[model samples]
Target: MQRRLADNITSDHLSCPICRDTLKDPKLLPCDHSICFECLTQLIESSRRFNKFSCPVDRREITASSYTLSAEQWASSFPTDELSLLLLQTISGDTKTETKLKDGILCSDHPQNGCDFFCFGCYKIICSECAVENHRDTECNCKNFKNCADLAREKLRDAYDEIENLIITGQDIVFKEIDKDQLLLQSRQQIRSTIKKLKTIVQDFEKMINRKCVDILSKVDSVTNVEELKKRTEGIVKDLKRVRDEVELSKSLTSTKDILTVLSKIPESLQKNTDLLYSLAVSDNPIELKLELNEKFLNLCETLIDQPIGTVHVVPADTIDFEDTEATVCSKRIKFSSDVLPLRALELDPFLAIQLDPSESENKITARFTGVIIHGHSIIAIDNANFKVQRFRDTIENQFIDEVLIQGIYDITNIHENDDVLVTSPGKQSRLIRLSTYNSLSIISEKVTENAYFSISQLPDCTFAVISHSSPTSSKKRVNFDWSRGVTSHIDIIDVDGNVLKHFSENFLCEPNEFGDPFIMPLKSICCLPNGNIVVSIETKTNSFISCFNQNARVKWTYDLNDTPEGVCFDDGKIYVFLRESKAVRVLSVDGDLKPVSTLRLPNYFGDGYSLFVGRNLLSVIDRTELIRLYKLQSC
Candidate 1:
C-alpha cells in the first residue's frame, strides 16, 4: 500500500542528472550534485579521455582531498552519497524498495544468477558462479544466505542497540539543560545584586555632591559682605581728618611750647590714624569667587538621564520535554553521537605509507623530515638538515615526485586559500619563502625579529604568525626552561610581503594559571584554527601546553600536557598536536576547556614526533627519524 511514482512527490532532487532515474548508489560530486555510481564511472571515464574529471553540472574539475586512487579504484576514492540514497529510499514506491533489495541479491558479473552465499571476510554477497570463480582461492568464510535476511537482521539489531543508547544519552542531555537553567537562575541573582550595588553607589555620590554644594554656597555668602567693609573704611577716613586738623591748630599756637605739645600730639594722632588705616586696609579688599562648571560632568549627567538603567532580561530556558516520544522512535533514526550522532568511532589504518630509503646518489633529495603539510594530492615535507622541500603523492607506491632545493628550509605550511606552501628558515635573512611549485620558491616574506624564527602558520586573513625563540641559537633545542633558557619568545603576525600586522609580546602571549602566575613559556609551534583562533604549542618550565588565542591576541584557554608538544595544526575545530617525548599525536576540541577527543600513538621506531597535518579523513605525521606516515581515517 504505497503511492505510485507519478502520484508521489517527484522533483528534480528525486532524479539523478546522469540517468534521470531514482538515484542508486549515489555518489556526490564536488559541486554537491549526485548521480549513480555507474553513471559517475562513465562520467569519469569520459572526462579521463579529455585528461580531466569534472562535475557534469558545473564542469568544474574534481580535486578532492582524498589521495588519487587509480582509474580502477574510483569506487573507493569517492564518498557515497548516503543521505541522498536514504532520501530516495524513503520517498520511492514500496515496489521500488523491494526491487532495490532484490537488485543487490543479483550478481553483477552474472545478472541471471542470484547471490546465495555471503562472504564474511569480503563483506559481500556473491552468487554461486562468482563464489567458485573468485572466492574459491580466497581465505573467506562463506555462509549460505537466502536473500540477505540474516544480514539485514544483524543490521537491524545494531540499529536497535544504537537507538537505545541514543535514548539514554538524550535523557542525559535533558537533565544537563535543567542544570544550565539552575545555573542561569544563580547568574540572574548575581546580576541583580550587582545592579543594586551600582544604585547604592549612585545614591552615595548624590549625597556627597549635595554636601559639597552646601559647603561651597556658605563660603560664597560669607565672602560677599560689601556693607560691613564700606562702613569700616568711612570711620578710618574721619579719624585721619581729625588728626590733620589738630596738627593745623598746633602750628598756629606759640613757638617752643607749641612745638613740644604738637610733637606729642602728632605722635598720638599718627599712631591712632595708622591703626585705623591698617584696620580699613584689612577690610577694604573685595572677596573674589570663581566657579567653573565642568562641561564633561554636565554631559555625563545628561547622558545618564537620557539612558537610565532598564530592567535586566532573564532569558527563558529551553523546553526539555518531548511532544511525542512514540513518533520520535517510529520516525527519524536516533542520534547517537552528540557530534553527528549514531555515535561513531574512527578507526585509522595505513592507506598509503612510505619509509624513505635515502641513498647518497646524484639528484636525490634527503628524507630527513622536520615539517609536513598536505597540498592537494601531494604530501609535502621539509628536510631541515639538507635544506630541501620534497613532494610525494599520498599513495604508498609513490616516491618523491618533485623536490625544490632551497637553502635553510626548516618548516613548511600551506597558505590559507592557495595551494602555495610557506617555508621557514630560522637563521636565513629571508625567513619565509613561498613555494608555488616543486621547482619554484621565492623569499616573499621575512620574520620581524632579531632572534631566529622557529615556526610559522598562515591565518585566515592570509597573514602568517611567526614564532621566534626570543634569542639566537644554533642548538637544536627550540624550548628550554633552565637558566640557559632564552628570554620571552614572540609571536608576530606578518603579511605575505613581510609587513608586521600584529606583534604579540610576552605580556600578550602569557596566560595566568590557578596560582595567578602567567604561563610564559618558550613558543615552539603556531597555527590558526578555523574559528579564527590561533593555537600555539609551548614548552613550559615543568611540562608543556598548547594555548589558543582569539583574534584580539587574548588567550582563550590553555591545555596542559606532560609531554613536550612540538608541531601543531588546527582543522575542522580539532587540534592536532605532536608530542615530542611520547611520540604520539593528540587530537582535542578547540573549545575553551580543550576537551580530549582522541589520540593516535605512533610506533617507537618511528622516532620523535615532529609535525602533523590533518587532511580530510587523512592524517600525515612526520617524525625526527626521517619518516612520514599517512593514516586513512575510517568511521566505524
Candidate 2:
C-alpha cells in the first residue's frame, strides 16, 4: 500500500514540466511549479535579452530583477522544492532514518530546542516551538527537517556527478585541440617544402636557359669573321669614291681629248667594281648565316614556357582524398573534385514572392531587408525598417516560421557549423547579437561595439569580418548634413569574443583639405569565401567598386561597378554582387581574376535588390518593397 502511494505521487508530482521526465534537483518557480535545474538554466540563457522567462507548464512569465547575475546563478537562485525532494526520497526507499534524524539540527533562534521543520516562507530550518511561535500564524509552509535534509543531500550528489562529467568533457576537448595543432604544424611544414622545391626548379630553368643562350652565340661567332667583312666593305666603298672623283674632274675638262680619256677609263673602272661585287656576293655572306635551332628542342622549350612549373593546390581538409595516386607532388597525392556550379550556366526558374510586412506591427514602415541567409529549407532575413529578424519557409506558400524583435538590426550572417546566426544592430546602442536556431529563435548573447557595424561575414577560421562605419554627425549634433565631412570605415577581423584581431582602412581618391583630412569611402557589404578571401563593396561619391582581399588583408583585385552595390555573397566559387541602383546581380569568378561572368537582371518588381542569399540551387533576394523573392537555379 505504501509503495502504491509512492508510485502515485511520483507519477503525479515528480515529473519536470520542461523535459517531462522525473525531476532531478527540481527548482520551485514563483508560479508554484517544479522544473529540472538544467531546463531552467537554458530558459534563462535563451531569454536573457529581456531578463525574463516563461514557465513551460503555466506559461507564466518570471522576471529576474538582478540582471547582473549570470544565467547559472539566476537558475540557482530559485529555492529547491523540499516537498518534491521528500516525495522522491520516499519513492527511492531512502527515508528509513528520517524519523531518527528529525531532531538532529538545533534551532538557531530557540537554542534549547532541536530543529524539526523547514519553514518555506522564511527558508530556514526551525524547531517545532519556533515554527509555532514565528511561522505558524504567518502562513509559512513547513516540512519535516529530516526529509528535507535527505532530499538536499540527493540534490548535492547529482550536482557533484554533473561537475565530474563536465571535467571529463573538458579534458576530451583539450586533447582534440592538441591533435589539431599537431596537424596544423605538419601542414605548414609540407607547404614550406613544396614551395622550396618549386623555387629550385625555377632557378635551375633560369640557369639552363642562360647556358643555352651562350652556346648559340658561341656557334654563330665561330662560323664567321665580322672584322674581315667590315674591312672588305670599307675598301670597296673607298674605290667607288675615287672613281666618282676622277669622273667629276674629267667632266670639268674643256677638250674632246680629255672627254675621250675619261670615257675610256669609265669602262675599266665599272668592270673592276662589278668584278669585285660579284666575288663578294659569291663568298659566304655573314647576314645569310642563320642560327637553325633543333625542331624538337624548340618545341620542348615552348612547352616548358607555356606550362606552369608546379601548382600549389589548397583544398578543405575534409575533401582531400589521400588514396588517389594518379598525380603525386611532394609525396602527397590528392584527388580533386569539382562541385562548384558555373554561374554563367545557371538558368533562373520560376520565382515566388513572399510578403514580409508583419500584420501586427503598429509602425507602418516599408520593409527593407538589409541582410539575408538561407539555412536549410528556411530563408532568414533582417527587416531593417521593421526592426525584426524574420524566417520563412522556402516554398510556394512561403509560410512564416518565426520572427524575433531586434532593434536597429542591420545585417545577419550564419555560423555554418551550428546553424546559429549573428546580427549587427548599429543604431543608438550598437551591438552584435548572436542567436541560436536549434530548437527556437532565441538570443544567446550580445557584444557591444564602439562604432556602428554595417556588414558582417564569417571567415573560414570561424572569426568574423565586419565593416564598421562612423559618420561625423553620429558623434556630434549637426543642424544639416555635410557631404564634405570625413567619415571613417574599417574592415575589422574579430574573434568570437568580439576582440578585433586585425583592421584595414582602404584609401580612396579623395583630396585633403587645408586640415589634411581625406574622406573615407563607406563600405557597404562584405562576404568571405571558403578559401579565406574577403570581398567588400565600397561606395564612393561618384563610383562604386568591390575589392577582394586575401587572408592577410592584402588587396588582391578590385572590380568597378556601374551602380551602387548593396550586398555581396560567395556561393560555390562565384561572387554574387547585388547592385541597388542597376537592379542587377553581377556574378564574378574568383579564380578568373574577378572577371564578370554573368549579369542577372532583376525584374521591375524586385525594387532595389538590397540583399541576397545563394544556396545549392536556390537564390533568394530581399528588396525594399516588403517582399522576398525566391528563384530556383538550374544548370543549363
Candidate 3:
C-alpha cells in the first residue's frame, strides 16, 4: 500500500498553483496555498497601485500593512515551503540510491559495505570503514553523499534563477525588434504605392501627348487635300476663259478665213485644257507636309526623362560595439607622458576650391559664409548674404548639392550622435533652431531666448554654451578701450528648452592694467571640449587670444596669439584657432598651459579665414571672398 501511494505522487501534486510548474523556490501564501517566488513577485508588482493582491487559487485579497516595502520584499515576506523542498530532495535522493544499490557499488577495501560517503579531497566515494581509515584527516573535507548532493542542487537552482532573468530581458528586446520590422515593412509598402501612382501619371501624360499628335496630323492632312483641289480647279477655269475669248474675237472679225482660224485654234485650246484636266485627275503625287515640333520643348522633355523624379537618401545605421575588458585594460596600461611631445606639423594639401554659384542665390548677392561644419561626408555652410544654408559634396570636385533659406542665421553646430544641427539666430528676438538632416534640411523645433546669442556650441552633457555680446554704445570712440569703456560679453549655459542654467559675466578674460582698470576683450567664436570646458576666442585691436574656462566660468588658462582670432573649434585633444590676418590655423594643446603645438598655413591668395571645420582626415575653411577651400591632412 505504501509503494502504490508513492508511485501515485504525480507532477500535479508538486506543481505550484500560480505557474503550474514543478515547485521551484516555492513560497507559502496566507491562504495556505503555494506559488513560485518569481510569479508571486510579478503579481505583487501588478497590484502595487491598488495596495492589494488576490491569490490565484482562492481569489482572496491580501493587503500589506505598509506600502514602503518593494515588490521583491513583499514576495519575500511569505514563508518558504520547506515541506515541498524536503519531498523533492527525498524523491531525487531515492532514485539515485536505487540505481547505485542495483549496480552494487561497494568499496574495494571493504567489499561487504556499500560506498555512501564522498571524500571531497580524494574525489571518490567510500564506505564507512574506509572513511574512518583513509579520509580521517581534517584536510580531506569529506561529507555524506546526501549533504553533498543537496549543495550541488542549490548551486544549480541559483544558475536557473539567473537564466530566468535573462529570458525576461531577451523577450523585451525581441518585442522591440519586431516593432521596428513592422515599421520598415510599412514604409516599404508606402514607397511602392507612391511609385505605382507616379507610373500611372506618366502613362496618362503619354497618352495625352499621343492624342494631340494624332489630332495635329489629321488637321494637316485635311489642309493638304483642300489646297490641292483648289489649285486644280483654278488651272481649268483659266484655260476655258482663254478659249472663249479667242472664239469671241474670231466671230467679230466677220471673215471666212478668220472664222476658220479661230475655230481651229479653239479646238486646239480645248484639247490642251482637256489634257491638263485629265493629268490633274490621274496625278498620284503626295504633297510634302512636314510637322515641326518646338526644339526647346523636345529638349526639355528629354532632360526630364534623363533626370530622376525623386531622390533616395540612405542614412547610415547608428550602432557601436565596445568591449569592457579591452577598454579597462587599455586604460590601465596606457599613460600619457608629462613632458610635452614634439610638435608634429601636418601638411595641408589643397584638395579642392569651390566658388559659390551665383545662380543658386535668389537675390543675386555675393556669398558671405558665416558658419561652416562637416556633417558626415558633406560640408554644410550658412550663406549670410542670401540667407541660405548650402550643402556640398565632400569629394575632390566639391560639387554643390542643395540649399535651403534660413533668415538671420549666425552660426551652426552639428550633433554627432544624431544627424541634427543647432543653429542660432541673434537679433531682437533671438532663437535657437534644431534641424533634422536625416531626409532633408527641415526645422524640428525652435526655442526663443531673452539674450542675443552670437555663437553656440554643444556640451558633453547635451546642453548648449552660448556667447552673448553687449552692443557697443555710440559714446565709445576708441576701439581698444578697457572693459569700463568698451563693449563686453557674457556666456550662458542653457538647456534644450532655452532656459539658462548658469550665467557667467564678471570674470571673462579680465585682467587689470597698470592703472588698475580691468581690460575686457571682445568675445568671438566659441566651442566646448569633451571635459565640459568652454573655450572662446577674444579679439582685440592690438592682438588676440583664446581663453579656456572651467564649469564655474573662471578662466583656467589663456594662450596669446600674434594675429586676430576669428573662429575656434576643438578636435582630438587639441584646439584649432583661425587667425584672420595671418590666414592660417594654429593648433594648441588642450593640456599643460595650453601650449602652441603647430601651425597649418593657408594659401596666400586665400582670403581672411572666417570659419574652420575639421573632419577625420579633411579640413575645410570658408573665406570672405565667397570661396570654400578643402585640404587633406597628411598625417592626421
Candidate 1 lDDT, 315-379, residue by residue in tens: 54332211111111112323221211101123357766665655653546556777888787777
User: What is each predicted model's overall lDDT from 0 to 1?
Assistant: 0.65, 0.72, 0.71
lDDT of 2 at 569: 81
* Candidate 2 C-alpha RMSD relative to the actual structure: 30.3
> All candidates' TM-scores?
0.41, 0.42, 0.43
Measured with C-alpha atoms, the lDDT of residue 199 in candidate 1 is 90
Model 3 spans > 4 angstroms off:
1-346, 396-398, 472-485, 518-521, 541-543, 591-593
Worst ten in a row by lDDT for model 1? 336-345
Q: TM-score: which is higher, 1 or 3?
A: 3
Candidate 1 clashes between residue pairs 3 or more apart in a chain or in different chains: 336-342, 337-341
Best candidate (score: lDDT): 2
Give the per-residue lDDT of model 3 (tens digit) for 60-135: 9989878788889999999886545544544455665456555857778866456667776777777654665577
Model 3: lDDT equals 0.71
Worst 10 residues of 3 by lDDT: 321-330
lDDT of 3 at 20: 73
Q: Which should have the higher TM-score, number 1 or number 2? A: 2
